[model samples]
Target: MTHTAALALASGLGFGLSLIIAIGAQNAFLLRQGLLREHVLPVVAVCSVSDVILIAAGVGGLGSLLDAAPWLVDVMRIGGAVFLLVYAALAARRALRPSAMAAEEARSGTSLWPVVTTAMALTWLNPHVYLDTLVLLGSVAATHGDDRWWFGAGAMTGSIVWFTALGYGARLLRPVFARPVAWRVLDALIAVVMVAIAATLLHGL
Candidate 1:
């Protein structure tokens, strides 16, 4: 493979690995829904699809535009920081709130559209997603020169594989999350993760 191709492969793997390892809002929501064993497929499908679309858009031709438009990056940075901070506080509030004694399973009866809509909103609303996929990862792809498209494709491929694996894999933990404490613990962890991301974003700003 040419040098650019190799770089693209490595960068794609890096982008995927960076996201897969992070337990952010998206992953936390997925894990919670997964533990509940409700609407797992729809939630995961939405997350994966959203990622693909963003990655494609970022890589298709917007990398240079984003780079040139420094003001846009600044806007995204500030917006992302504010969003994460608010989300972090909300997560903490959810953690502190008392839960019902009964371990109520998430109602999976709703049509799949709710699942899809919620996932899309969560992923798309956060400016951090733009920072991660559109700015950071897209910039990496741009470095690949003519092979940038392949790099974008590879990065998106990773999202598809990951969400599918995580969604299906969560079924294995259904029994453990049957307890109310399990959910509280999971939510608490999620809160911590969100707070950390928020802190990081603020610090960077």
Candidate 2:
């Protein structure tokens, strides 16, 4: 690999990580799933694959498409805000019921389809994901001359690495989340973060 290409790859990695490594609805959901050791692989796969698709689209000129239809962003933004707010309410309700937070029962009883659906919604429904992976990252990738694909590859790699680590590494915190109070706190935090993000999205719109 050329040194310049390597540099572009590194830059893309940094950019991707910086944008995603945040306290958001998707990360909160993934963390919860990880703690329960429930549907972790599917959730991670959904998120990672979604990012790969978004990044690829962006690099392949989704930016131009987006610009041609600015209302698309607004539609996504509204849809995302509604989903986040609804999820936040659900999380807050969970926080209120420590007994229902039954990690064991919840994990065993929950089916794969619901988790997969939520993961997809949290990923694809979030307008920020579109803006971040499509507009911002796409624009940046275009600036990399002949090495833009390398940059896109780096971003894709970053998404995979971060999601894999977050999903699997959360097991290390299992001991902590084993306590009902810990679950309550985590749920409360998730609720707050979701609402905050939703508010920001609405405010921007």
Candidate 3:
């Protein structure tokens, strides 16, 4: 690889990871799913694949299409806010009823379909994903000229690696989350984060 391409790749990896590592609605949901050991593979697959598609679209200059239609973002923002509010309500309910937070009880109740659907919603419904992957990453990738694809490949690598680590590594926290109180605290925090993101989305709209 040319030095310039290598630099672009490295820059993409760093920038992508930095954006994704933030604690947001998607990450919070993924962390919860990881802790529950529920549909982890599916959840990770959906998120990673979604990121790749979005990144590809961005790198391919689909951001221009979005730019031409500003109303699309507004629609997504409103829809995302509603979805987040509903999720926050569910989390708050779980936090209030500690009995529901029991590890074993939480594990067997949810079907794979719902978990997968929720993962997809948490991912695709969020307007910020487009802003980050499409607008921000796309704009940066543009700086690489012909090496933009390589930059995208690097960014895609970051997403896959991060999600795999987050989903699998969450098992290490199993011992800690074994306590019902831990689940309660985690759900409460998730609730707060979800609500805050929803509020931010609404405010933006």
Candidate 4:
């Protein structure tokens, strides 16, 4: 590979990982799923594949298309905020109810379909996904000139690696999460993060 291509790939990997490593709605949900060991593979697949598609679209100039239609962002903002708020309420309820604080009890009742749906919603519904993957990453990829595809490839690789690591690696924490109090604390924190993100989205609109 040419130096430019290598540089672009490295840059893309760094930027992509940086954006994803933060504690956001999607990451929080993924972490929770990972901790519960419920539908981890499918959830990780959805998030990684969604990132691949979005990064490809951005590299193909879909960011430009989105820029032309500001209303699309507005719609996403509203939808994402509503979804986040609902999730926040659910988390808060779980946190407050001592009976629901056990991870095993919670896992027994959750179906695969709801988890899959929530994974998709958390990934695609958020407007920040578009801004980060489409606009920010796309703009950076453009700097690579003809090697933009390589940059995107790097970003996609980062996404896959990060999601895989996060989902599977969370099992290592299972012992810590075995306690009811740990689950309660986790749910409470998730609630705070979700509500904060929802508020940010609503304020943006």
**Full-model lDDT, candidate 2:** 0.88
Task: For candidate 3, give the lDDT.
Answer: 0.89
| Deviation (Å) of 172 in candidate 4 | 0.9
Across residues 119-205, which tens digit of lDDT does each residue of candidate 4 receive? 999989999999998999999899889999999999999999999999999999999987878988998999999999988988987
lDDT of 4: 0.90
Off by over 4 Å in 1: 1-11, 65-114, 202-205
RMSD of each: 3.6, 1.7, 1.7, 1.6
Residue 84, model 4: Cα distance from true site in angstroms: 0.3
Give lDDT: candidate 2, residue 118.
86
* Stretches of candidate 3 exceeding 4 Å from the true structure: 102-110
Candidate 2 to truth, TM: 0.95
Better of 1 and 3 by lDDT: 3
TM-score of 3: 0.95
User: For residues 66-97, what per-residue lDDT tens digits would candidate 1 score against the true structure?
Assistant: 66877776666666556656656655555566
Q: Evaluate all candidate structures by whole-model CA lDDT and list the values in order.
A: 0.72, 0.88, 0.89, 0.90
Provide the lowest-lDDT 10-residue window in model 2.
101-110
Residue range 1-205, candidate 3, lDDT tens digits: 9998898888888888998999998888888888878888999999999999999998998888778999999999999999999989888888998765555355645578888888899999999999998998999999899999989988999999999899888889999987878888888999999999999989997
> What TM-score would every model get versus the actual structure?
0.76, 0.95, 0.95, 0.95
